[model samples]
Target: MSGQLFVIGLGPGNASQVTPEASHAVAEAEFFFGYGPYVDRLELRPDQTRIASDNREELSRANAALQRAAEGAKVAVVSGGDPGVFAMAAAVCEAIEKGPVEWRDIDLTIIPGVTAMLAVAARIGAPLGHDFCTISLSDNLKPWAVIERRLEAAASAGFVIALYNPISKARPWQLGSAFEILRRHLPGDTPVIFGRAAGRPDERIEIVKLEQADPAKADMATCVMIGSPETSIVERAHKPPLVYTPRFSTESSQ
Candidate 1:
């Protein structure tokens, strides 16, 4: 008898942000498999076993978790933020598609949690209140040219853009290049938000203009939001400004 497998998202580095559904899944799982830091977020009981690997070993981790589940172990594959959003949920799905026939037969459940972009948006205001799209700035899985094209297209189309994996040691130049691409289509005064470790104790949220947006301000933990032309900032006395995109668009009036 094959056991169950749960793909769970832990939310954006905050215990409070983790959904009840995800907590239930975590409690039910006997074995957990995930990247090192994400697995570290779990406060597992003595009976629960954790198997951690490097961040880049997603496929191998998924296969190992599936194998355990096939052998009747209640397994959980974990990711930070939403599992489906550029995370381990897709990795597990990819493994299932190309993995053994039995792997597909294993009972699977995906538990959702708050992603980074949502957390970041909440910290400031609703930049994602209007039509928007997310793009990963990392070029490991796809070409940099494709990223550039998407950035340009999204900007030109007036979509509020949320950029994940904005910077890393290996790909230091990608975020700068992404900013350059957006500049061609967006005005120099467009508001750009750099939200780092949002909802965590060490959280930092900064807003800047598109022309002055510094890529060096970001790390892998940051979620950068580039506002559309319609996005606005409302200033308050002695308080941080609220950044948002109006629900109504001027283009719609035409």
Candidate 2:
């Protein structure tokens, strides 16, 4: 009797953003495995055990969780945002693929949660209202040239771009380089949003133009959204501006 493995997304820092399904899954889990901060988010009963590892150790964490599950323990692996979005879900699947045959026998359930891009988009207006694509700026798994090429391709295609893992202490220059690439493809006046820790107590959302965007505004916690050429902003009296991309494109008018 192989045990069950639940891959859960805890959502962006806010408790309210956590889905009920995820909550239920957490309750049913006897063992939890995840990054330290993400696992700490859960209010597990004393009986439940948490095994936390470094955020960068995704594969190792997945293997450990699978090993426990194969031992007939109901285990849960948690991610801060959507587990499927550059998170633990993929790692677990990869582990199962290369792991022992018994690892594949464990029943797996994936519970979704609000990701950073969605949370950030909701904070302002609908910057993602139109065509959009997300790209992670972290070059840890991929090469920097690959990231730059994708940024250029996404920008040239006029897709609203949401960047994850935008800037970290270790890789500070990449975000600035990304902005330079965007400036070549996007308009100087295009809206760029820097949403940090969306839905959390220390949340900060800043909107700027492409030319004015400073890389210093972002950190590892920030989700950077660069609007398409078709995106627009609506100004309000004594209120923050609302930014949105029109639903209909110029080609649609034809």
Q: Kindly state the number of residue pairs that clash in model 2.
A: 0
Worst 10 residues of 2 by lDDT: 245-254
Q: List the residue pairs that clash in candidate 2.
A: none
Error of 1 at 49 (Å): 0.5
Regions more than 4 Å wrong, model 1: 252-254
**Residue pairs in candidate 1 whose N, alpha carbon or C atoms collide under 3 angstroms:** none
Considering summed lDDT, which 10 consecutive residues are worst modelled in model 1? Answer: 245-254
Q: What is the lDDT of residue 231 in candidate 1?
A: 99
Candidate 1 TM-score, C-alpha based: 0.98
lDDT score for residue 145 of model 2: 92
List model 1 lDDT by residue over 141-195, tens digit each.
9988899889989999999999999999998998999999999999999999999
In order, candidate lDDTs are 0.96, 0.96
